[model samples]
Structures are given as structure tokens and as C-alpha cells.
Target chain A: MQYPEPIARLIDSYMKLPGIGEKSATRLAFYTLGMSDADVDNFAKSLRAVKRDLHYCSVCGNITEDDPCPICKDKTRDQSRVLVVERSRDIMAMERMKEYHGLYHVLHGTISPSEGTGPQDINLESLLKRLEAHKEIQEVIVATNASLDGETTAQYLAHLIKPAGIKVTRLAHGLSAGADIDYTDEVTLFRAVQGRTEM
Target chain B: MQYPEPIARLIDSYMKLPGIGEKSATRLAFYTLGMSDADVDNFAKSLRAVKRDLHYCSVCGNITEDDPCPICKDKTRDQSRVLVVERSRDIMAMERMKEYHGLYHVLHGTISPSEGTGPQDINLESLLKRLEAHKEIQEVIVATNASLDGETTAQYLAHLIKPAGIKVTRLAHGLSAGADIDYTDEVTLFRAVQGRTEM
Candidate 1:
């Protein structure tokens, strides 16, 4: 039996989100139906607001209500050190730790040849321009994921920045905290041994 | 660091959805931010439309754009039999089977006293009224779940409908099809033995 038009439409919209399947979309649609009109309006408004109000930060490529984003505009953050990440969401992760007080450069995505995403496709051009314009910036920390594409992007960024006489570094790879040594994957174990810290 | 107002609000709305946690909400919010304007507008509109357009069918409690609902209006269905279910979603499950061509009565919820949900809180009044108004309904099938509240609701519905001199039936409880005997719970195995068929 066919669902009502509105419910079907809602389910289809929900299915477009990442990781949500048919069953989950149906469940979410029903849940949305059960919500109060005010709550539903708020939810809908939030969805529109995210798209309508936000834009890419001019300086860093992160999403922001303002042009430069709060992080980029803040003068107190270390201007000499720049942490380059694959997406704006990764910036949130780093911010949550509260340990890093440096500026950020969002790549939006990594260089993936299989996906046909090259250096020209992502936010790499702006990073190079920013580096060229800001000679005081001494170090660029490449904090992309441990995946092949992420490594390729980091290496590519290093190659581009090293000639400009700026230090380019990638995040260290090791076994994660609370990980069991016996169950750790070979790559992580190998990295942990290779990058062993001095006690 | 706090997320931008729009992003934070979007994440908060996503978190309100069932089965979505903080991490998933963050992921969904970022995904929403990345969506094209038209796609975002469609998502937002769908949410609003589901709540604004859909209403309960007057004949049955199932959700629909029409007052009587398509199922209730369909003349080909067996009007003499009414299958009672806990929610509108359950009606979809029954419809998917393509076997039951009877009318439906959605209670919207069960008689759970601990949750302060009594018969008066649900759509039972309309069911009784419908039964009284239409004498042609030969059987009232109490297809509530097999949980404590579901059983209580089924028994209560049976008691209410039996005095009208109509047939009242509950769904059979037994081992599910393709269930492993070794892994089967004792209650299900016992029920399967007790409800054994002659065939």
C-alpha cells in the first residue's frame, strides 16, 4: 500500500541524509508526524536556517554565519600555526579538545583519484594563497584521517608548503587511548612502535 | 567552543529524532549544511508538510490527508472485519502483507496504566461508536502487540466488544517462522507447543 503523499515525501527527504536507510526514514517520518506543530516548525526552520544563514568562512572554508568565522577573526589564536583539516566538522572536534589554540584551514574534502576529486576540486587553492599572503605563519599541521586519500592530501600539501620555507607536519599515528594491545590492528601497532615516545 | 547558532540549532533538532545520538546529530547537521539550497528547502518543506497536512482519519485512527482515509473509503475491503492495532504505523505493516483486506481501527496507543495511558487516552471511544453505528462489522480482531500492555488492551477490547454479540479475536502467539529452535526463548517454545495445529 502506498503511503500518504506528505509522509512519503518526508520519508524520502529523511532517506537523503547520510547513514539513514528506508526503515529509519520511515520511523523518522512517523516521529516527525507525532511532534507538536511548534516543535515541527522549529525543526523545519532549523534545517532551512542552516542552509540560509550559513556560508563558507572566507579565510578558512569552514561554515560560519559571518565571513571569516569566529576562529579566524579572533586575534588571540596563534596566527603562526595553522591546522589543516579535511572538513569543517573536524574543526569542531579539535575545538572540543580545547588544547589547540591555532588557526584552521578547511579543505572541504581530500584528494581522491577514485572519486575523481583532485587538488583543484577541494579548498586547496585558498590554503596556498593564505600561506603565500601570510609569511609570518611558520607551521602547518596536516590533521587529515589515516586513510590513503588523507595521506595523499597531506603529502601533497607538504610538497606545496615545504618550498615556501614553512614547516609542514602530519598528525602522529598510534594506538588510540583505551585500546587493548592484543586487539589493536597491525598498522596501528606498527605506528605505535615506530613513533614510540620517550618516557 | 560553541557551534554557530544555526548549526547548533540544527544539531539540537537532529538530536530530538529517535535513535540519533550526539555524534550522529553532529554528522547530520554538517551534512545538512553541505546540502544544496533546493535540497535543503525540500527537506525543510517536507518536515513542515507532514505535520501541517496529515490528520487522523475520522473513520479509523490512521494518519491520512483525507478525513475518512483511502483505506476506509475503499469499498473492496471486507467491512465486516476490523483489525485493531496500537498505532497508525502498524496499519502499514498489515497492509504490506497483502492478505488482510479488512478495515482497521488504530488505537494510537495501548492501555498502559503505569504510563498513565488508560482506554480513555486512546482512540477506543471512536471504535466503540463506529461498531455501534455499523452493525455489519461481524468480527473485531484485537491485533495488539504481545507485551503486557498489549495483552491488557486486547483483553479489555474483547470484553467491551463481546457484549455487542460480535466475534472478538486476538492474534495467535507462537514460534516465529525460520526461528532457530536452539536459540528460541522458552516462552515462545511453550506457546508454540500449546498452540499446536492439527495440520
Candidate 2:
């Protein structure tokens, strides 16, 4: 026998999430049924609240309930150096390292000419406007991944910032991760060898 | 900074589902935020509807929207034999095989002494009463899995039903398809040898 129509519908709702398939969705729906009545009600209420309350930060484009966001408004952080990244999740990763004390600028996405994504498509205009308005800024670190798209975007940003007499630096490359020499990609292998240091 | 209070609450709600940890819950919350408003509303509506509409079938204890359920009401199926199963999913599996034409009785669960589940814990009394009230019933097939708990429940049923002057049988077993003798577990290998037949 199949689930009741509503149960099936709830299962379908769960299946919309990333990595959750039909079987997992059904399991999740049954699990929900076992939850307390208040918990289920709270779950449904939370779904609605996230969509209603959360918004993008106006200055950095990070997810926030406030327009300027906590990082952008913080007076203690270094305003001279801004780390440019692609998404809010990247901000989380950076925060976990506890290495960077500068403010951030989220480009939201990279330029992919084939996919109709250009500099105009993302929040680059805001970065330019921020740089123009904030004269104290000295360095802009392009902290994007070393993928082709990230490199292209970083190069494009460097070209734009270099004309403004601001220093632009790319993240350094080193031995990557759990990778065997035989299995490593050619580009990564070449980079590793080129950037190798003598002890 | 972390998500806003409302968004964090929403993420926490998604975390309550089975197999969903904190990070996955946050990902799902973001995915939901990306969904269209209509889809989000439909998802919430379906959850409420499932709770409101679902009922247990009076005859077999399987979940159903109606009292006796479609399977129990179908006159074309063999009413004299009942395939007693552990859950509704088992009924779906049997139906997919297209070999079983008899009716079904869902016990909802098996007797597990460790879990404080005994014969009275499941719908065993209802099943016995159904068997006693129906004179046309000639055989009962115990189609529970071959797990230790399933075996224990099957043995318990065999003792209960043999004195009622009714025939009872279990699904035959030897070796599973696509299993190698070298890789098969010792118990399964022993059963395979014990049940071997001459060609």
C-alpha cells in the first residue's frame, strides 16, 4: 500500500533537497510523523520564516537579516584589506581558519561567458563603488579557488584594481591534499612541481 | 556570523529529520529558500494533509485512507489465503513481483523481546481473530524476513497456528541470486548445502 496523499506530498517535499532521493524522502517523512506535534508545527513554521526573514547583506552580499551585516558594520576589522569570495559558505570556511582579520566582499558568482555570466551579472559594481567611496582601502586579496573560472575572475579583478593603484594578490598554491603523484591532475602536478621548495 | 534567529530556527527544524545532521539541515534550508513560493506552500500543505487524512485499515492494520482498504475490498484476490507481512512496504514489494494473488495482513512490526515488543505489541490479536472468524481461510503464509527477530516471530506463529488445523509455510531459501559461495555468510552457505537438490 502507498502512503496517504498528504504523506506522499510531504515525502515529495523532502525529496526536493540536495542528495535526498525517494527512499530517503520517505524515511524522512515517516520520521517526521514520529516527532512531537509541536516539533512538526515548529518545523513547518521555520520553513516559512527562513524565506521571509533572511536577506542578502547590502555591502558584502553575505546572507543576513541586517543590510550592512555584522562583518561589514564591525569597526574593529581592517577596512584596508577586503577578501573577495564567491559565496557565503566560503565566508564560513574562511572564518573556521581564523587567519584573516579583514572584511569581505562576496561577488555572489564568477564570470562564465558561455553561461551568460559576465562581470555585469554579479555584484562587481558594488565592489567598485565601495572602493571608490572608501579611500582607506590598500589591498584586495582574491581568495577564490584556483579553478579556471576563479583564476579568470581573479585576473579580471586584478586588472580592474591595478589601475586604481591598489595591490592585488592571488592565493598561493602548494601541495594539495591526500593526492598521489600518479593520480593528480596534470595542472595541479605541474603547479606543485613549479612551486616546490627545498628544505 | 551565524544565520539570523529565524533562519537558524528553520535550519534546526530540518535537522530533526532522520539521517539529517546540522550541516545538511542548513543546506536543505537554503535549498528551500531557493524554491518557488508555490512549491514551499505546497510542501507545508502536504505535511498537514498527510497527518489529517491517513488512517489504519481496520482489517489488516496497514495505513489506508479508507477503513478496509482497496486490497481488502478487492473481490478478485484470493480471500482463502492471507500473506501475513511485517509492514506495508512488504506488501508493495510482493505486489511488484506479480506472483502473490492472496490477501495481506500487516502486523506493523514483529515481536522483539529486547525492544519490549511481544505478540500483544503488534496486531497479532486482530490477525488471530480474523482467522477465527473467517471459515474460508485455509492457509496462512508467514512471509517475514529471515532475520533473527523475524525467525523468532515466525516460530511463535507456527506454534500458535499449527493446532488450528490450518497449513502454514514459509518462503523457501537456499542461496540468494548473484551471490558467490566463497562470499556467502557461513549460515547461508550451510543452509544452501542442507537444502541442495539433485538435478
Candidate 3:
């Protein structure tokens, strides 16, 4: 016997999310059913609100309710440096550290040969145009993840930005702060050794 | 920097789901933003639909769109037997097997001393009333899980139903088919030895 129509639709909707399978979808569906009515209302309202209210910031390619985003709108932030990341969530991680005060450019995705995601597919064109418009930006810091596609995208961005006399730098990748050398993976260990700092 | 209000609300909503944390919720919120408008609309619709459309089957306590549920309404099913399970999901599992043709009773939960869940907390009163009404149900098969609470519930059910001249049975406990003896846990191995039957 099939799950009733409403629950089956819910399970199917949940299964569309990354990493959720049939069993997990079923569990979530039941849990949703058990949730209080007001909470469910808020959940559905938020679901619609994400699409209805949010938009891509025209200047930075970051997700925002405002057109240019709060980051771009703020004239007080440092204008000389911009950190580039593959996704907007990386900006949250950076901001959480409370260190970086420079602007950011969200690529939205990385170029991958296997996936056929070309450089043209991502939000690179807007970044290029933004740089062309703003000569005060002296540095472009690539904070894309250390994955193969991320590295490729960073390299491509560096090559393109270097012609404009802007310094292009990649985030230093090494063994994480608390990670032990013995337990560190080979690639991380190799990067740690390669990027050793002067004492 | 804070995420935009809409996306932040969406992340908060995603975090309300079981097993989804802040990071995962952020990922899901972004993924949802990337979804097509139609899929997102459907997702929100399904969320609302599960709450609005489906309800408990008053007869069997299974989740259903209809009042009695398909199984309870069916006149062809065996009237002499009733399978009692801990949750509505269990009925889905049983129906998938297609081996049993009896009606079902959903207990919703098991009796657990540590958690302080008693027999009265589950759907037991209706079950007793149903039994009192339906003299044709000669046997009650307790198909709760094999945990301590499940066993306690089964014994309690047996104790209560036996006085009414109804036979109470339990799902067999032993090693599952294709389970290797060397890999089996001690309790299962012991149960396998004790419940050995003639070939």
C-alpha cells in the first residue's frame, strides 16, 4: 500500500533535497506532520519567502534582498580589497571570524570540465565588469575551497585579473589549526609542508 | 555579515527539520533558492497539504486521507486477526511485504520506563474498546520493535488481551535470513539457538 497522497507528495518533495533518500524523506514527512501548526506555517512561509523575497545582488553576485546588497551599499568598508568565494555561505564563515572587512565577490559556482560548467556559466563576467568600473580595488583574494574545481577557478581568475595590474592571491591551505600531523591526510600534509611560514 | 532576511528566515526554517544543523540548513536554503519556481511552489504546497489534507484513520490510527483508511474499509481482509504496531510507518512496511491480510492497530509508541511513557500514553484505550466491540478478532499480533520497551508493551498487551479470551502473539525473534553467525551479536545468536525449529 502506498503512503497517502499528501504524505507521499511531501516525501517526494523532501527527497529532492541533496543527501535525503527515501527512508529519510519518509522520516521527515512524519516529523513534519507532528510539528505544531504555527511552526509548519512558518516553514512553508519561509519556503515561499526565499523565492519571493530574495535576489542576487547586482554588484557582488551575492544573495540579498537589496539590489546591490548591504556589503556593496556600505561605503565605509575597505574599497582596495575584495575576497572571491565560490558561494555566498563562504562569506558567512569569513564574517564569523570578525577579521576581514574587505568587500566580497560571489562566483556562485566553479568551472568543472566533467560537468561542462564553463567559465562563462558562473558569475565571473559581473566580477570582471565590477573591477573594470572600480580602479581603487588593488587586490583580489581568491577564497574558493581547495577542491580541484575551486583551484581551477582560482587559477583562471588569477590569470584574468593579473593583466589589470591587480594582485591575485589564493587562501593559504595547510593542515587545519587543531589537526594533528599523524592524522592529517596526505594532500593537507603536503600543502602544510609546502606553505611553511618563517619562524 | 548577516545573510539577507529572506535567506536567513529560510535557513532558520530548514534548521527546524530533524538532523539538519545550521551548516546543513544554510546549504539546503541555498539549494532551495537554486530550485525552479515551480518546484519550490510545489514544495511549499506539499508542506501545507500534509498538514491540511491528511489525518489519522479513526478506526486504525494509521495516517490517511480517508476516515477509515483503505485497509480498515476493505471488507475482504481477515477479520479474525489484527496486527498491532508501534507506528503508522510499520503498516507501510508490512503492506510492502504483502504476506499479511489482517487489519492493523497503530500504538503510535511503545511503553518505556526510562522515558516515563506508559500504556495510557499510546493508542491502547481505543484498541481495548475495539476488541470489546469486535468479538470476531480472535488473535492480536504484537509487532512492536524488539527493544526493551517493545517487549514490555507486548507483555502488557498479552496480559490485558488474554483475559478477554483473545490470543496474543509476537513477531518471532531470531537471526535474520542470510545473517552470518560469526558477525551476529550475542543476543541474536542466543535467540537463534533458543528458537531453533525442525527443518
Highest DockQ model number: 3
DockQ of 1: 0.84
lDDT of each: 0.93, 0.83, 0.93
Ranking by DockQ: 3, 1, 2
Q: What are the runs in model 2 whose C-alpha is more than 4 Å off? A: A1-3, A113-116, A175-199, B113-116, B174-199
Give a tens-digit lDDT track for model 1, residues A1-199: 8899999999999999999999999999999999888888989999999988999999999989999899999999999999999998899889999999999999999999889999999999999999989988999999999999999999999988899899999999998989999999999999999999999
Candidate order by lDDT, decreasing, is 1, 3, 2
Whichever of 2 and 3 has more DockQ, that candidate is 3
TM-score winner: 3
| TM-score order of candidates, top first | 3, 1, 2
The 10-residue segment of model 1 chain A with minimum total lDDT is A35-44
TM-score of each: 0.96, 0.85, 0.98
Residue B153 of model 1: what lDDT?
96
Q: Is the docking of candidate 2 incorrect, acceptable, medium or high quality?
A: medium
Q: Which runs of model 3 end up more than 4 angstroms from their true locations? A: none
DockQ of predictions, in order shown: 0.84, 0.54, 0.86
